[model samples]
Target: MTTTLRDAHGEALSTTDRSALAAYDHALDLFNGFRMDPVAVLAPVLERDPGFVSGQLLMAGMLLGSFDGQLFGMAKACVDAAAASLQKANERERSLLAAFGAWSNGDALRANQLLGRHLIDHPRDLLALQLAHLGDLFLGHSFMLRDRVARSLARWNADDKGYGYVLGMHAFGLEECNEYARAESVGRRACELQPHDSWAVHAVAHVCEMQGRVDDGIRWLKSTQRHWATDCGMAVHNHWHLALMQMASGDMDAALKLYDEAVAPAPEAIALNLNDASALLWRFQLRGVDVSGRWKALAARWRLQAAWGCSAFNDVHAVMALAAAGDEDASRAGMAAIAEAARLHGAHAWAVALPAGHGLQAFLAGQYARCAELLLPLLAASSPLGGSHAQRDLLHLTAIEAASRAGDRALVRAMGDERAARRLVGARPARTEDHVAA
Candidate 1:
């Protein structure tokens, strides 16, 4: 008789080693819980049974998800290790490894397709669904974000252990696709089901940001603060959202305070943490606040990060920090890295990002008209940059500020009209007339 262990979704493991199975299950529990330490839990499982294909695939997925250039090597190693054990794995496990292989090899579209196919065959494969959701996020495929989760959600229910997580992911998808009301409702429902579901909390935050509901965002984040702030992997990002809400509510003091207390003081200055710091400080600069030392701190971390330049999205944020810090040498190096990366791995995404990065760098250099000229036309079609609408709005804000500084009344009005039409700038300084005066 083969001893088997099951995942949270009641899927049987391919490994007959009871310890490896238990470790694999433990790893999944950690992942679903958003502990962000699944790799640590899964490491022992892979060691105990070197042929544990499921464990290998899980490790690979987590490594790819890290969004760290250093980890790409690790992710590729996991893919290679799993190749020898492919025959021992199930069909689903084999497909999972294939997706990992593509993603590690810099073919995100193919990875997403493989994950999509795997989900179609096994909608109950929560791991595949989650990986696909992340892949869609990287590809900036907003429709796929919502639809991929929706397609699999029919197979899930409240009775499922990680149902809240699935709902949270779906809510983010819906939020990205502009279904604000429904996204908020579903996100709240997810938080109700599991208060510790940080992704769900973030989904609601995204809705609030998009809808310009500052008070609602603040209240929602505060009310659910403990769940995410204490143990969630996305604690800093959640704080970043709260800071945005604070800034929107005209509370820059509180927002900057949060940055000092929670956001920038990250244990490890990864791209995620550094991006939040750079973005928040940039927003402050736009609002005419002096973030003198903040840019220097952020730029330091980015100097290390710029060496790899694996993703164009990360490259843009790094340039923002370096440019703001007025580190001409680092900025030049970072820009060169971005150009090289785009030239080497230039997809539709990098094409948009490359000019956007140049525009941001130009803005920091006080070349306002140049910034406006570069960013204005590309504003509408900038989705391939692979960030949330809120994150991408930084580009729009930069364009507006650049236009304003250049005293380009026509450009300011054009950008302002778009914001006003969307009700994104009601009677605020971003209003056309006020911005034109600046």
Candidate 2:
């Protein structure tokens, strides 16, 4: 690791000096540690390597991965750097990276366009095919993602790896459509194509979680996360997800430990801080955990801006925290920002989220009747317009709590009858280590 690879006379490396290298490594380490904002840690490196900004892409990825998109400003300049890097790379790689950058920055349309262009040239660019599939996944463009995967499957003669990507993506898509069996099968095939792939793992998690197979979700989480933990950045993200899972299973203390690890560091504006820290708080509040102090500290630096859709997501989570903590003024402020950046797609996005948020606030306030009223509509909508496993689980869980408190038999019956019947399943031919060497 110490030996120079680029040259002998040029300090044996890139970025002009070791200071920049140290900065980059520090940022990367923090990134791997907790998905915290890499922008803070990366600042020193960016200052030194202004001309070389490909590093910004990682910062954006950390942001996007966490679903807290308010840290885009810190990485805005880096987007240009990344774009420049893409231009400098080979046409195919550039196109793929460009699509990735767009997706990371919360612009699926741009990602779709870039992937589209790349597909025109290489028709079977595996990277483009995957990016296109993902762009559609997040953009509420299910048909587009499905169709692209279909074309890729046909064009590539259904290569197993490519099929894995398509099926993995479709696993989530089917989950969205309440086609749990289809979701499960596709997800399992994706895992078979390349065991240890994160998407494949996620698909499997969905299949298990939706079927109420907690043990299965736990096994998938354990194996997949144990492997990811070797890398600090990936492990950090894993912890974030793990925290949520633990809390979902009523392990608040365990979740808290994970949360502490997720955001114990000094605050930064980069990807690692933004994602890991912000997301930790959001999930805490979502789980009905009192994260008031975290919210206050986080809100101080949280501004509303659309640099990479970070502002919207961050603000939304912050709003949830404030509302739950009973800070009306602060909560309203947070909601104002979130309203603009709210995710609106699928038949139940607004119906589900709006009510769920209200019910959460009410639950926090001990207003069970209001909670039931608000959550009932969402529970009703969710079965028909399903979503990602975690998302749908959240919808049902909130409703369960609300209805149980309110003594609403109809709500209980609806969820049990409509949602429980639908289950997603996924599997792989065999377990393979080192398959996700990203």
Candidate 3:
């Protein structure tokens, strides 16, 4: 007799192969819980049952998550496998394959649209929902991120297996949309339901970070750090959060120390790790902390990926590292790569890149007025650039510094006052550095 396994929604998987079912279930659990090593778990399943369409779909999505150009070959293979096995899949599985096909072709928006319609018919499809979340993330559709989870919540209850994960995702979306209080509450509730849910932990961390609750952020991260420290995929990012809090408290030494211990020498040369490193070091540079020699190391790592053109956000960071290191050739090449990607991809690729590339180059050249002019307009549309609000805040910080350097005292003061009001700065940090001078 053949055995079947149910997905998070209790719907039976189309596959009856026992090993495939086991691997798929294990992969789902690890993925929904944000545990590490999901791909390793799924790989054997694909090997065992080449006809497993869902396995092919998932493995392809996982490869894309790396955002590494080298992995494109494997991702394409997975997509092709799914396409070849289409006849073996159910209607929903086939629909998912179609979406993955678009995703494999670098058309993320189309894949997301397909997933969106898939959800309208099968709101309980957790796999579809997960992919949709990625789509929202890549598009910088913050409102969509929050609303998509909200739309699916009616079909889930606390008793459901992955309900806590769903709530955690919703909490993150809310935080991205600036709904701090509700985000905190929902995220905390998710953590209560599933202590090991790293996404929930991350969501609450974002709330504290945005609210400028430095003490709260530190305390919460410290208390919950162990749950995600070992097995969670977002561990380094969580540490990055802690470092940000330390920086906000004017503990530059602590921030740098954290960077060395938890961040730099990334486990992988992937864009995600590289972005955090650049963001932190750039913060140091903005504060005139003399991050000498550091940019060279970062730029060296980025040189390997400078030509990947995977994302405009990543390309901009690469430019930052190269420009700081005085590698004019690499920086210019990075810009060229971004322009080509924008041209080949669409407006989504260049909309932010063109301005961001020029702005970064202008800032490096000490043309502060030009930098500010190029960056200010894109601040409101930063979401389309594809990163968390915290990550995209790099643009705001750079703009503020440019405005300060341009002798636009009124603009600088106005921006500072607005940040202060929103951040609820009762007592400012002691250091009055160049980053805050204006």
Q: Write the per-residue lDDT of candidate 1 for residues 1-438, one digit (tens) a residue.
A: 234567768775677777776777677766765765777888976777777878888888877775666678888988888888876777677788888899898777788899899899988777778778877876778899899999989998798888888999999999998898999999999999988888899999998887788888889999999888965678888999999888777887998999998888465656767777888888888888889798888788887665345666777888888889989888878778777877887666788778998898888788999999999877788888787777878888888888888888888888877875654521133343685655
How do all models score by TM-score? 0.94, 0.61, 0.93
lDDT of 2: 0.51
lDDT of 2 at 155: 50
lDDT of 2 by residue, 1-438 (tens): 122322111112323455655665555434433334456786666566664433455454444444444444444555666666543443444555566667655665676787777776765544345545544554445456445655555554455324454566656666555566777787777666755445556666655666767666776778767434543344554455566556556677877887776543344333434435555665555445677876665555443321322332233344554564457876655554444444543332333444555666777677867876776665544432222445434445555555555666655556544544654221110111112111
Q: Sort by TM-score, best first.
A: 1, 3, 2
For each candidate in the order shown, give its overall lDDT on alpha carbons: 0.80, 0.51, 0.79
* Per-candidate clashes, comma-separated: 0, 22, 0
Tens-digit per-residue lDDT, 1-438, candidate 3: 223456657655668776776787778778777687888999888887877878887788777655555676688899899888766677777788788778777677788898888888788877778778867876788898899999999999899888998999899999988899999999999999999898899899989988989889889999999898776777777888888888887788988898888877564646777777887888777777777688888888988755456666677778888888889998887878888887887687467977887898898799999998998888767777887877777777777778887878776766566556555321132322344662
Query: Which of the two, 2 or 3, has more lDDT?
Result: 3
The candidate, 1 or 3, that scores higher on lDDT is: 1
Task: Supply candidate 2's per-residue lDDT for 203.
Answer: 60
- Candidate 3 versus truth, CA RMSD in Å, comes to 2.7
Winning model by TM-score? 1
Over 4 Å off, model 2: 1-68, 78-134, 141-147, 154-196, 232-314, 340-356, 379-387, 423-438
